[model samples]
Target: MINKIVAIQGNHPSKLNSETDTSVFLAHEIQSKNYKIFYYDPKDLSVINSKVIASGFFIKFNYKDKKFFKILKKQKLNLTKCKFILIRQDPPFNLEYISATYILDTIKDKVKILNNPTSIRNVSEKLYSARYQKFMPSTIFTQNISEIKNFFKIHKKVIIKPIHSYGGNDIHLLNKFNSKLINQFIKRHDHIMCQKFLPKISKGDKRVFLINGQVCGAISRVPKHGSFLSNMSKGAKPINVQLTKTEHKISKLIAKDLKKENIFFAGIDFIDQKLNGDINVTSPTGLKTLYDLSGVNLAKIFWKELKA
Candidate 1:
């Protein structure tokens, strides 16, 4: 039997936070299936002789161990040899990220790439939510100071965040719009997403996990004291919760679209039944937190769909 090899494109292990790291949890989950995990950074991939080649080491991780990761071997592999490739790197979605997508798009016919590289490149997590704005809160995509000011005028209280950002970084809750700061924000981020700030966010936001375009499980991420960002990485606490009727309806709608887009997995947020308009696609996290709080093993469901 040919050994199933799953190649993961991600950040170096040195930079990860093991406590709530989703990639590490996923790697460990699949390891039990007797599949070999090949780890590499997106920067380490190249096109050699019309083939996708990734230079990395095979690592085996387990919960019970003195040394957590045991390296089996190192090799330069043509991606065609890989049964599955997971593009799991966190993103700024910069030029380098786009270039990697272009490279990976080449071998997609032969190798199964999760969350399809071409699909991810086409979908800018925050911006892609624009298409379903009727289900979303008052939102706008602009870098101009005047436009943002106009949005704030209508929404009163607004949230301003960078289009290319994730993990709740650079997210700002503006009660009163400041033109100068808005100008500075636009200058820095190039394009920004401005939306009506939902007061219910103080309670929590629902993060729905979709695997193979199916809503598998979800968890509510309650913000820390006096804060509104519900990213687990941003110190939000996960809570066991069920999706409301409205949340389930919206998830179903988006799930169909995601499947059409070839997005194998995605994480989307909701506050007070209103779509937050941040569809976290590139390295969508919070799975470990979900499992910890809800006892719903989404990682198992994720691999089940992948294997199917």
Candidate 2:
């Protein structure tokens, strides 16, 4: 018999925001389809007797509840029994994250894993965009202060981001370079992504969702007053928006490439019609926010395409 379980290898459900978390949105949808939700943390994953197992709880998600989730049972589960596994953890993409992917790599053939563990292992969420630099704003990846200073000199205004962080954390927009700050940032993050600050970011950025290699839907996120970051967690507001022709073209190309790379779902951003270099394959978000804004449910598309 086919397994009816969908394992979510992620942070605990209690830590997720039902209002905007794509994992919660996805679980809520799959649960409606009668699939049991097995939620686990990366640290809970183990391999013993050649069986990959997770020490976690079966849970339920109720969007209407003040407290959104309830643990049904806590136990150890052999991951191979699950028909699907969603790697939904947020990332600093450190060693722990890599180790989890390596563990998951063992059972990828037995269970369907979104964004494929091996692919996630190989793809750096930020650095992977280097292949499409022609479609992106002028950008550089380096930890060397001298190279960063030269980039700042050329670009004038620059956006600095840690190579592994998520949700707008540790990101900075520098109008002018400060050696002390640059050195400090380098020491903390090791290597960073520096890009020409797109002044048009004040207008907002478009986050386009790709499912099974198709550009399914999109929404514009306008940064709050006096901010350049457009992440919802950073106070950016989502609004109904349509993709520009250029945006669609770039998105389609990237989507196809990601599909070839074994990535089933992704989100890419555009600022001033240029790729922002954030190809979010590792736990891509915004589906919940997109549905709320325009009533377009990519979550439905997501499951249907997977034939789950």
Candidate 3:
């Protein structure tokens, strides 16, 4: 039998925002169910004698508290002994991230990993959205400068994004194509995703939470003044918002597809009802913000669905 332990493979607590961190929120909810939370960084994970182990610490979370979370005790754990393992690391989708997934894949069957490690490795958060291109903005994934130049000629204004990045980092909006900048961006990122710039982003972008193949809730994150990036971490203010029929339909289709892919939780964004080309599977966030805005408490739904 699996122990009443949920091991989280993520960044250290100090690096997380106590105010809006979904991982801590979920961990707090799960802890209420009497499950111990074991927190660890990716570097702490290792395989010895074919056993997956992590050197981490027991942690307790309380939303009402100023500190929010406290480390209780230190321990080195055999991951297979835990009831659940959450791949909660932020992504650059670099070699180390991929290596962690490969290591976790070995013990996936032994523990209930939130997203099947093999499945997460197979899904590219941006590239996988191509499966539903009809719902997205005109987008291209390439490193070819010529193709990007031609794309700009057709689209006029475009947003350039690093394919392997997250949290609105290394994203640029080009009003007019500058070949030099495009060349440098391509060289830095290798391959990048360029999409038609959506002006409606000035209003906000809606982030929909999909848990267990169902649309649980959503919040509109309005970008800060003079910015187009709507990521909450990028200073976007989140507000409660209702989904339009088209947005709901798009979310439903993506949720069903993700469930089939064995991704138990995800977040997808929409700008003016158009898919934003990010299918956030690895460590999808926004639960705390959702709770703050709407009092819906998706963290409760998250744990309930897992238990069910």
Candidate 4:
């Protein structure tokens, strides 16, 4: 039998926002069920003598406390012993991240990993949305300057993003084609995601949360003044919002596809009912913010689904 423990492979708790972190929120809920929480950073994961292990510590989470989390004891753990392991690290999705997934893949049969390591490794967060391009704004994935120029000519306004980045970093809004900027961006990040700029983003974007193949909840994040990015890390304010019929339909289709791919949790974004190309499976967030605005505890739903 699997022990009542959930191992989280993520960043240090101190770096997380207590009010909006989904990892800690889920951990806290699972802890209430008397499941021990083992927390570790990706750097501490390793494979030795054909076994997966991690240097980590047991932790307790408290939402109302100023400190929020407390470390109980430090230990080296065999990851296969846990009932579940969540790959909750933030991403540039570089070699280090890929290596961690490879290591975790070895123990997957013995533990329930939220995303299924192999599946997350195969799904590129931004690029995967291409499969649903019909629901998305006009977008392209390329490093070709000429292709980007053509896209710009058609759309007039465009947004350029590093395909593997997270937290709204290195995203640029270009009103007109600038050869220098486009060339420099391509040189810096290689392949990139370029899309027609959505004007409605000034109002907000909705992040729909899918857990266990179902559209569980959603929250709208309105960008701060003078910004186009609606990520919470970019100071976007989340508000309670209901999904439109179209949004609900799109989310359901995506959720069904993700489940078939063995992805257990994901977040997808939309602006003015049009899908933005972020299929956020790599540590998808927003449960805490949703709860804060709507009083719906997605964390409880998360665990209940896992139990079922």
Regions of model 3 farther than 4 Å from truth: none
Clashing pairs in 4: none
Give the alpha carbon lDDT tens digit for every residue of 31-106 in model 1: 8888889999889999988888999999887656755677789989888888888888998889999999999999
True lDDT of residue 215, candidate 3: 92
In model 1, residue pairs whose N, Cα or C atoms come closer than 3 Å (at least 3 residues apart or on different chains), thus clashing, are none
Better of 1 and 3 by TM-score: 3
Q: Which has the better lDDT: candidate 1, or candidate 4?
A: 4
Clash count in backbone of candidate 3: 0
Model 2 worst lDDT run, 10 consecutive residues: 9-18
Residue 299 displacement in candidate 4 (angstroms): 0.8
What's the TM for model 3? 0.98
What ranking of all candidate models by lDDT puts the best one first? Answer: 2, 4, 3, 1
List, residue by residue over 50-128, the lDDT tens digit for candidate 2. 9998999999999888999999999999999999999999997999999999999999999899989999988899999
Write model 4 residue lDDT over 240-280, tens digit each, in one string. Answer: 99999999999999999999989999999999999999999
Please provide, for model 3 over 174-236, each residue's C-alpha lDDT reduced to its tens digit, 9 standing for 90 to 100.
999899998988889998999999999999999999999999899999999999999988999
